[model samples]
Every structure is written in structure tokens, then in C-alpha cells.
Target: MPELKTPDSLETQSCQVILSVLYQLNLNHENNVAMSSERRQFILDCLQPSLRQRLISMITYSLNQDLNVTCKLLDYLFDSGIPHLDLITRRFSSFYFPADQVPTVYRLLSRGDPTSLEKLCIGIHLDHSEEGDWEDEEKETICWYSGVKRKEESVSKVLVYNSYFYPTLEKMKKLRHVVLHGVCDNQALSIIGQSCNLLQYLDITGSSDVTDVGIQNLVFPPAIQKAGRVNLVNTRARTNPSMKHICTVLARDTGVDVTGCIILLQFCPRQWI
Candidate 1:
């Protein structure tokens, strides 16, 4: 085995090893002694700052590979107090891990500083078609950050999965955009409306739980109202009798585009209007 060099040299050597391990793992070959050696070296290289940054960038870009490897590398980078951990978070705009792998990824993310984790746009996609016995997978994924405390006062954006919206909303105060799917009742929307004052765009499509009463309470403050777009597609508000009131408020509220107003009246009868 090669003796570890000086601290600086060790960092560089660790980076090289990590890079080599990643390259080899991506190859379509069987695992062997050589592969194992490369893997060990890669782990070592991750200890160096420069090498760690490079490795993090690679893993962030190549998340489709072994999720375990990428997550392990992330844990190492985070634990080492790497300065670029924020950068790594920014690079990870989406997560496409399998249902089984979500818990591991969530656990690792949960352990990191909330500010570090919030720097990235975390997205979890749930396919009802995907076969698995995972219990309440959506709740598990969303609740990962339940107890996390935000060091910073704000975050860029937060896009949540179907059922994960309620818990994650209060923590994200500086969000610029939010995309909500599935059913969210009046209370959920109200919670979001109150907490996220800086939100610019909101997409709540296919949400059957949002009613006109809920929509009525979602008032965009004057500042955000100046540059905000709300997309409410296939929602219960489409046919609700109270939609007229909702539309009237939106029309009176300057800065909101009324061109998409048809969505509100789509399911409502002509007589209702």
C-alpha cells in the first residue's frame, strides 16, 4: 500500500483516486481487485479540498450512476467541512433515486446543515406505477428536513412532491418559485401564502383539494404581485361558484395576468358566471 503523503499531497492524491474510481465504476466491466483498489483510492482522494470539489462536481453531474457512491461521496464532502458543499447542493437540481434509495439520500441530507441542503433544488418524483412496498414514501421523503434548522434567512426555490408540501413550506422563507402537485386544501395554501412572501411563481395543477375559499385567501403581497404568475390547472376551483369572486379579486389585483383566467371558469356552468 502507498504511504499517505503530506496533508496537501494526500488531498491531491485522494482526488485523483476518486476520479479514477468514478471513471472505472462507470465502465461496463466486472468488479475485481483493480476496481476495488481504484475505489479505495477514490475514497482517499475525496479527503482533499481541491480533489473533493472536482469529485463533487462529477458526482452531481452523474447522479444516475450508483446513488450509494454519490451519496457516500456527498457525506464525506459534507463531513470534511468542504467549502464547496454549497456548490454541490446548487449543482443538484433534481433527484431521481429509486424509492428504496430515497431514505438513504434523505438521511444523508438530513444530517447536513439546512443551509447547505437548502442551497440545492430538491425534487422527488413519485410514480404510482413504480412497484414497491415502501410505506408512505412521499411523507418519508418530505419529512427528512422536519427538524432541520436554517442557518441562513432564505433559500432560492423549493419544488416539492405531491404530499410533501406542508412540512417543507414553513422552513423556506426566501423561495422565488414553488411547484405544488396533487391535493392541497385551504389550510396548506394558506400556510404557504403566509410563510413564503417572496414567491414569484406558483404551479398547483391537478390539485383537487384546493377550493375557491382556499384560492381566495392566497393574496400575493404588492411586491410579489408586481412580478408573479400563478398556474392553477385542473383544480376544484375551476367549477366552483366562488370562482367569480376569485377572478374579481385577481382582476383587481394589479400585476397578475388575467389572460389565463379561463382556467377558473372551465368547469363552471355559463349560468353560474
Candidate 2:
């Protein structure tokens, strides 16, 4: 790993101060989540251009929502246009967005350089709207992604299985870490195994769509290749166990191990944690 440049003490202090003030302001409140465009501008106007990305990063983190939900407000915020929009989108290499954002993610990949992307994590937005529920803590709030409190019943949950989205991901040759929780499909998983040469970690837990066919694509590509960059494939996979043994047999000789979480396949067992 290369040395990372840490921000100066002053910038760190500034971030601390800004975060404190933001908490007090309650912009994260349910009522304010989908704030008016003017309100979004007000917050941006208060920050220096250099610090804007940090502010956005915090909001994105707090929301912990997929890029699709976060970007909805962002697109509105940048409606009037602002500086550093490109800076935020282009420089952000790590993405942990829901599968619904695949189209949006594709746009981000297509418009920007795919080589810049490093970590891509895609998972399903857990929908708890089951038969019945009563616990306050267990109840889902906001629109799944937003941290705001739920005002009413949420709209339908979406599961993305588009073919085009996978193609865009293939272009991300530099991608490394990936986590597909509850949303890993066979085709997409197959693409990741064959295309992502530099891939290090993949965590697919509780996903039912994956099977040995996908693992086959990952462990044995159609053609010969150079030394692989794979390090570990972690599977806390809980949904499908049928493919567990198949994966084990396929990768046992190749220094990869299989466990159960859907189907966990490690590229280098020695390095697996």
C-alpha cells in the first residue's frame, strides 16, 4: 500500500467544527431530508470550495444510502450549478450504493474515467415491510436510504438485473474490493470474476442468485492469463448452500477456499481472514 496524505491539522479542526454545527442544525432531520433546492444551496454557500467535498462525504456517510438516493438531492443541489461537482464525482473511488443506482453508476462510469474507481460495493436495500412489525427500533425510517423518519408507507422496492449495467462495470478494470449483499446475481457475479483482474475482496452474503456457474467464470476464465491480482473472496453467504461444495471443489487446487454465505470463494486462502 502507498502512503496516504493526511489533511493538515487546521483542515481536520475545521471539519470537526463544521460537523458539530451541522448536528446542531439538524439538516439530517426527517423533515429536512428532501429540503428545498434553495436550502441545499444555503448549506453549500456556507462552505469553501475546498471543504465542500468533505461536507458532502459526511452527508453521504450519514445517510448511508445508495448513490441513487443521495444523488437525487445532489442533482437538485447542483441544479443552479456549482463548482467542484466534477471533483466530488470524479475523485470518489469507493462506492457503496444500492443496485438501483446501477444505471446512475453506469452514467458516472461512462462520463468519467473508469480507471479511477477502486472499490465498488453493491447490495440490496433491505426491505422490512413484511407481514407485521411493532418494534420502534425495528421499523424502517425515511425512504430506505435517507436517514429521515418515514412519513408514510414506502414505495415499492426495486431489484436491478439489467444487462447493460454489468457491461459498464466491466470497464472498471481497476476495481478492487466489492460487496454484494442480497443482490448478487449469477451474470453480474460471473462478470466480476472474469473481468476484474485487480479484484481483491468480494463479500456475497445472504444472496440466493449466485451459484457455481458464476464461481466457475471467476475461477476459470475462457482464455489463459497472467498472474492474477486476486487476494481473497469472502462469503458469509446464507441463502444458497447448494453451490458451496461445488465452489470448494473448483477452487481447492487453485489456492482458493469455499465457505457458506451464498457461496464464499477465496482467491488466496493464505491471505483470507
Candidate 3:
């Protein structure tokens, strides 16, 4: 019988571990039986820092095509100690399907990667053309939602609907632009006010859950004394005429750009032109 030899080099073993990780991630994403947690850990422990960096780049490059799988793999890697938010953000250049952005944002945020949150964009957008809608039967009105647009390649815009992501916001230090819709409430706003000092633009359209308390937090936070743009369109603030004056006062006092002028007219019955 011919002698059988095992590959003993760290390079060879690292390659095997990477392959196993890829397979396990894909299997988990597909709802198949994935490699056991113990097995996964064993393989991950074999990777060196250099190999991890290389894997991150490779994962980022492959993300667009296999986002679900790659994201899971990224999560595993992040948890296993290759935890650099830059790796996640560097892959943002790839086009992601609008529907997948929400889950992706959750995954990234839960990882507590601050560098990735600096300029993040997460939301669900639907291409409303009749042809596109008809072709993609799964994309019904229930799935179509408001999301953020990339304003500048440099500045990050993170848009989420009904985001209860306040817990994760504390980890973000360099956030600049944020647009949230749906169920974002006073508490979430307060969290942002307390944590995101560098916030420049804030749009909370459809945030009916927010009230004067949140507005107070946004206006009075010591960290955000500087001026910034605020859009409260279609928010609970519309029901309270008094809050309008508060926003106006904040804007005047701090040179903040406070929109939602139309909503203000609901109570005063005057043209805001």
C-alpha cells in the first residue's frame, strides 16, 4: 500500500478551516443541518490573524452574490474574535437587495461594530414599476417599504423602518446621518440623542411612536448642542401643535434645519410658506 500523508502546514489547514466555515454558513443560511457548534469553534481556532484578514476580504468580495451566507460567516468570524467593523463596512460598495438590508443591519448592529455604523444604510426599498412588481410575486405591498438613499459616497446613511435598534446605538460613536421610519419611538430617539453626538441629519418620518419627550431629548442633549437638520414629517409631533413651536425654537436657537412645517399647520390653521 502507498503511504498516505496529511497536510501539516498552517496554510493548508487554514484553507480547510475556511472552506468548512463557508460550507457551514451556507448550510445554516439555507436552513440545513450545519456543522456542530463545537466543530465550528475548533475550525475557527485554527485561523491566525493574517488569515482572518484575508478571509474578511474574500468574504466581502463574495457578499453581493451570497449575502445571506456571507453575513452568517461574518457574524461567526466577528464573534470568534476577528471583530473589525471596517471589514463589514468595506463590503458596502456591493449592491444589496432592498429586502435583505433590515436583517443585515440587525446582524451588523448586534455585533457592536462601531466603525461600521459610522455611515451605515439599512432599509427596505421596492422598485414600484408594475413590470418589476408583477415579475417578483413575493414583493407585495406588505414587503415594500421606505429606506435610505446613498447621499454621498463618503457619508453613511442608515435608514430603517420600525427600528427598535436603540440598544445597539450606544456602541456607535461616529454616526452622522440617520433616517428612520415606522415604529421608532421616544426611547429610541433618546438613545440616539444620548449616544450619537456626531449626528448631522435626522429624519424620523412615520415615527408615530415618538412624542414631545423624544423631541426634548433631541433638542436638549448636551452632546448635540450644535445645529443639525431634523425632519419630523408624518410623525406624532403633528398632533401636538405645541411641539411645533418647540422645534421652531430649537431651530432658531441652534440654527437647526427643522422641517415638517406642513404638519405644524394642522393646529394653527395658517400657511407655513
**After superposing candidate 2, which stretches have Cα over 4 Å from the reference?**
1-56, 63-69, 73-113, 126-160, 223-268, 271-273
Candidates 1 and 2 compared by lDDT, better number: 2
Per-residue lDDT over 24-93 for candidate 2, one digit per residue giving the tens place of the 0 to 100 score = 4444552564554455568657665446555545555544444655554343323212222221222345
TM-score of candidate 3 relative to the true fold: 0.43
After aligning candidate 2 to the native by TM-score, how far in Å is the CA of 35 from where it should be?
A: 18
lDDT digits (tens) for residues 1-273 of candidate 1: 999765756755666676666565545444465754565455556455555656666566644556666665565454333333222233435444444444555455444333322222232343434423445333322112122112122211221222344554455444444444323345555665666554444445433334444544454323433444534553443222222232222121111223323433443223121
Model 2 root mean square deviation, Cα atoms: 13.9
lDDT for model 2 comes to: 0.45
Ten residues in sequence with the least summed lDDT for candidate 1: 247-256
> Model-by-model lDDT, in order?
0.42, 0.45, 0.45
Residues 30-117 of candidate 3 have per-residue lDDT tens digits of 5543544444465457666557655655666544545556566655444324433332233446233444355565665576354435
Q: Model 1 TM-score?
A: 0.37
Question: Which of 1 and 3 is ahead in TM-score?
Answer: 3
User: Model 3 has how many clashing residue pairs?
Assistant: 1
| TM-score (all chains, Cα) for each model | 0.37, 0.45, 0.43
Backbone atom clashes (below 3 Å) for every candidate: 5, 5, 1
